[model samples]
Target chain A: MSEMREATFLILTALADEVRHGYGIVQEVSALSEGRVALLPGTLYAALDRLAAQGLVERDREEVVEGRLRRYYRLAEHGRTALAAESARLRQLSTAADARLRTLRPRSV
Target chain B: MRRLLFFYPRAYRRDRGPEILETLQEYAGTSRTRLAVNLIRHGLRTRLGRPASRTVVVWAALFTVACGLFAAAFGSWVGWQTIRPLHESEAAQVAAELLPTQNLKVDTDEPPAKFVIYGQPLGWYSVRDLLLGDGGEYGQSGVGAGSNGPADHPERDLATLRENLRRGGWEFREYVRPDYGHEVYAGRGDQQLDITFYEYNYGASYISLGMDRPAPALATVGGVLGFLAGAVGGFLLFGWASRRTRSVFVKLLLGFGLFFWWAPIVLAFPQMVEHHLSEWHYSWHPLWEWLGQPALSLPFLLGTGLLVLALAISALARAQVRRADDPVPG
Candidate 1:
């Protein structure tokens, strides 16, 4: 399986919680990633369009609170499944690395 | 900056022009040393949908050159027509009469249709109508050239003169003003005569005649040449553009070809070949004649239609072949 980039992982993780508008999703992902990535508007929208085309996410609803339109998108079942598989894969890799590092530790002589 | 107005999609510009400008201003403000480079790069990308590649620049240069050549060829064609007299019988004789006495120089070696007199300058329509036979008041009035001020009414004078000539036994069957100017070709059989008047001003006029030859041949050749120039220019532009976008190339070719063929032709360099030319004849009393070199516009019309049809078919075939090679994913 291909490893998901941090940004993609954070996006999928944010949507795993609940449906969110574009701005809300951005804020949620930023908070979850601890400010490591600041996605530009172009990058964010491009990713969203691609993900939506793949049937991983979809527009759930739309509402206008002010002059601007707020579109909400929800994670599809396939997206949740993919996120779970990515998480499990990452956990296995991390565990194996930790074991290797412990064995390489220098003993007190 | 102004041309950037055409860069964006029309609907998008209409909706967000001010907003886009405001955003660009803010973006540019953050950079000082990189301002020019940044804007130029972004502008190219936006207008061309690609970076400023050498290929794109080369294509643009090629398009500009093709357009320039087409304009030059058109100029040459029109210039040749303006100076040469075709064989027009009654009209040629009338044009010859209208010439001032001092300008009546003719060479026996020259064909009857090739005679030209020089003296005073006259407008194109005034000479054309008189030589080709007038369409009466409406035509004269529409061109603002009826027998009033030469600037505003050459048509009227030419019309009245044509009516007189018609009554006086000059015969005109059909004619058209392809470019500005008048011509009449007459005679009984395969042999014909040509008379043309042009560049008239004040009371003076310049006229010429060629006898015993058909003027229709001249008209046909000129018209065909003009049509070819238009189609060839469009084809060159399409070839240059299709490298990047086939649909855009096809659309532009069709649109531009139609525009050149059907639109009212406006002379590009009108002032260069008028009024002050030494060949204008101004000394003679106005003599009118009726004649015609019929079917002038046919070749241009037919040629344009044929070329457009050919290009459209080629484009369709290319599109079909491309689709067959790469079927779309359902």
Candidate 2:
């Protein structure tokens, strides 16, 4: 498999724990990325549709909250495995980067 | 938010619109413009469905561009209809005034027809010729006059002609002195005139003049607007049809339609560009001519038929229904 995009990885990570609706996923992704990645409703839905089509996510359930329909989504078996692999790959890269940083002289600034 | 949902396909809007609205509502504090733009962009993408298939986007783009070109041509044609044809008598009078000394013969007294085949108005009789190998014979009608004998004083006549044209309110656009002789282009309002002086080594010089109208500014502006409208409409239609049908036969029909419609344009466009670059055109050949129309009208019609058939089939086909267990309403 190819290396996962930051947004996709974050989305999968967000859904790894509990089933969430569209807005829930957006909030979780933003929180996880330290507000660096603010997933809009449209962007979130597109990504959700793509993930669902790939069988990496599945529709979980629906709720009526404040007179609005909220369709929830959950990570699938394939998504869990893919997320694990991506996490390991990221960890390896981060470890190598940390080692390189330790060898470099500190900036005066 | 509701208006933004309009960008999505009908079936997609039905299935997912409420959920998307709910999500958007939750982020109401966010930039409405950014949110609206996002909805529109993704909504259009959603209309095409098949997120995994990259080729669908390419096909949609091609179909959109073809529709844009065709619409621009049609719009230009509509704009051309506003022009009043220059009468043969008027042309002859102008010719007489320009070359008073020379006994010029008016070879063509053009009929008031937008298009002609073999010097006659386009009609049922010309249909066969228009569709057949003689399609190139179909062309815009114009008045022309030529002189057979050599001018008594070629240089003096040329000078007098230029002065007469200027005094007659004709604006000189281009003047070229070739090895053979001189070619002058002048225009008055929408109408343009081309004068050529061909010098023979044996002293038998021939001078010819032709008058026609250039495409009005309306055509240029209308064509641009039409192109934009056609692009949007074509893409939306293509997306709707693409999502509604998974039939291989429909895809095949679409493929054939694209080939039939786009082949002529692909083949003719480069040649037309070369032609335009090769000469100083007072006005370009009409847009349809560049698309190889009339000559290739049969193939174009066939392509249109195929595309319409494909669209009809897609329209009749049942949209994919969401599973009953799925929470989203159809």
Candidate 3:
């Protein structure tokens, strides 16, 4: 089946806290990822639209500031579920790799 | 960590860009550079797998191809219209009338009715307008004019004109209007050019070419080619700016500043200088001269500007998305 990419994962991660507009989502994702990522408008919109379509995210509300329309998005129940699944998968992979390395390690003399 | 954000495509950056940034600031103590790199690398590879990017690019390419073919075909059709046999005879007959009575000689070797002008050389202005009567310079005067150049100057050297007429393939004619003055018309058929030396009250000389219809096929094709050229050039420059400066903000500013304000302004330089920014020539109409507005003046300027803006914005948005997910260099 289809799965969301890491960028999209980070997008959901940003929204995991609370609702956010376009810029707000970017800010949150950056904070969560430690400035390791950024999003531009085009890419953001494309993902937002796709996630909303797939029932992963929903438009929570709209606000206007400085004469610009900003649409705020929130994670849907489905989005939370997807994020949980991905987190579990990453955790499992990390644990398995750690275990394998420990068993295969060379002991220091 | 701050710089690693450059790895994501622009779309990824815009949606999650701010949050990711804020998160980085909040979690600065961790040595997460390696994780950031891995995330970016994964982000771009995933973005490339996206069907949307391919959809946009392919649609754009198809549109360009359609436009190019349309222009070439319409231009070719107009060319075909000018070379039909009857119009050729008409052109030859008209050319004969422009010659003095003494120079008109019947050619028995050819068709009995066919006559040739066998005398003195004529001045360029006297018969220049009549040569490309239907497919004249005027029709190609719009955006296509840049591509036309002097190759289609109609008034070929006298030797070529004479040789062309002797082959008996095309005809030339003359048009006389009390207001317009002595004119020569030449065409093979539907395609014709009526060439006339127009003298303004100010003593400036001008040449006017009229066409039955403006070729949409040509213009559509030309517009598409123009769009593709603009898109490719625009994307590369913006992408490079993002890389060199390591600033999305800078890239956005430069993209809009150059594409919308600078490029069109640059393209308009020649026309603006020539016209001196005066009122466009076709702005007013005479009371009785039922003839419609002559083509090519202001519409091209505004149309090109609008077209460029639309393409630039689309490309900018796409680039922003691609850059958002891009990985920063080590």
Candidate 4:
């Protein structure tokens, strides 16, 4: 079974909100991951190519800003589903860790 | 950034170059060096038509040739090892002609002839190449070693040896050979026998005999041809396959290639001193030497293997997705 890479997950998460160009998603992903993940242009674009190929995210529109044609991408139905599934999975994992830490935490102190 | 973009396949760049460039400019915190390296790796070669049609060529060729070359080298090493045992058996065969009661003689049956002296086997030493000719034909080597024989009395045994040779259907050179104490020569078909008796010291005599049959070099030639064929075929396949799959595996493979492609640039003295900001006190030579080890090459093999595995995974994932059609199971 093919597991989604963290970068792929982040890319999908970035597109889940609205249509965003390549740079927009890169910045958004960094902010969303809280600087824990910085998407290099190559990595971000490569992930975009893969996701687009997999029918996850797709080209939304193209706009020329500052003489550079920025292509925007938005999540497809599949992309939304996949992102939801992956985010839910991660949430479950974080919740488990949170529960485990709660037991380990000092009680009533 | 533009230069780095060239590391990608031209076709790929043709399709997405403008958009990617725009993204790069718009995207803050982009590492040009890392992106360049990544592009070089992933953009290795362009894919042909589509990803589905392109076969994994380099990985397959690498696997086959690696196995073939190793096997060939090992077989050659082993064949060279057989020279000693062969000489021993040849010596034994020669020894069998003499009465052990009168003189010490050891005999065994081992083909691929060699010369034995005083029961000590002597043949080619440190023989690097072993043709080991095929078609039931074997390679031959002649060796001559001096040993004290017959109580160091060649004068007493010369007449007796001559008589034995005559009886054994060996024709001797009737004339005294040039620059030799005593020499016996006999030939039958392609095989030649030569024995030289010389004085080793005061009242000490040493004798040497060598029998050899030169074998054809067809096997080595065939081996070389086969190796070349495998390499060439693999290269052609790579050229074809690279045109098909524009996957990350291909990109990384070429990115690794960029490391090699610019190796000379990296190693240039001026570039090392100036660009790399390193003092040129010959530290690079040691690094260069260290990197040249056969073990270092294993990383290349490992990296390629990983890429091939990734290629497989990509193909499988796509296949699974296609099989499922619409909705993919989480």
| DockQ of all models, two decimals each | 0.04, 0.55, 0.03, 0.30
- Output the number of the DockQ-best candidate: 2
Interface RMSD of each: 7.3, 1.7, 7.8, 3.2
**Per-residue CA lDDT of candidate 1, range B22-79, in tens?**
3333333334335343444333333343332334434443333334444434443343
lDDT (10s digit) by residue, model 2, range A1-109: 9989898999999999999988888999999999999998777877888888889999999999988898999999999999999999999999999999888958778
* Candidate with maximal TM-score: 2
Give per-residue CA lDDT, model 3, range A11-49, as digits (tens): 998899899877778777788888887665445656786
Error of 2 at A37 (Å): 11
Name the lDDT value of residue B224 in candidate 4.
60
> Which pairs of residues have clashing backbones in candidate 2?
none
Docking quality band of candidate 1, CAPRI definitions:
incorrect
Report, for all candidates in order, the number of backbone clashes: 38, 0, 70, 18
Instruction: Output the number of the lDDT-best candidate.
Output: 2
Instruction: Give the distance in Å from residue B42's predicted Cα in candidate 4 to where it truly belongs.
Output: 1.8
Tell me which of candidates 3 and 4 scores higher on DockQ: 4
* Pick by DockQ: 2 or 4, better one: 2
What would the per-residue lDDT of candidate 2 be over residues B1-330, giving only the tens digit for each residue?
A: 799999777987898999998888888679999999878777766668765454776788889999999998888878877777767876788789877777678888656586678988878998888777688787778888889777767778789888888788887754556677888888777778888888878865688888888888887877888799888899879988987888999999999999999988877888999999987676888888899886688889889999999999898774334343458758
The candidate 3 chain B region of ten consecutive residues with least summed lDDT is: B284-293
By lDDT, the candidates rank as: 2, 4, 3, 1
The estimated TM-scores of all candidates read 0.33, 0.71, 0.36, 0.43
Question: By descending DockQ, how would the candidates be arranged?
Answer: 2, 4, 1, 3
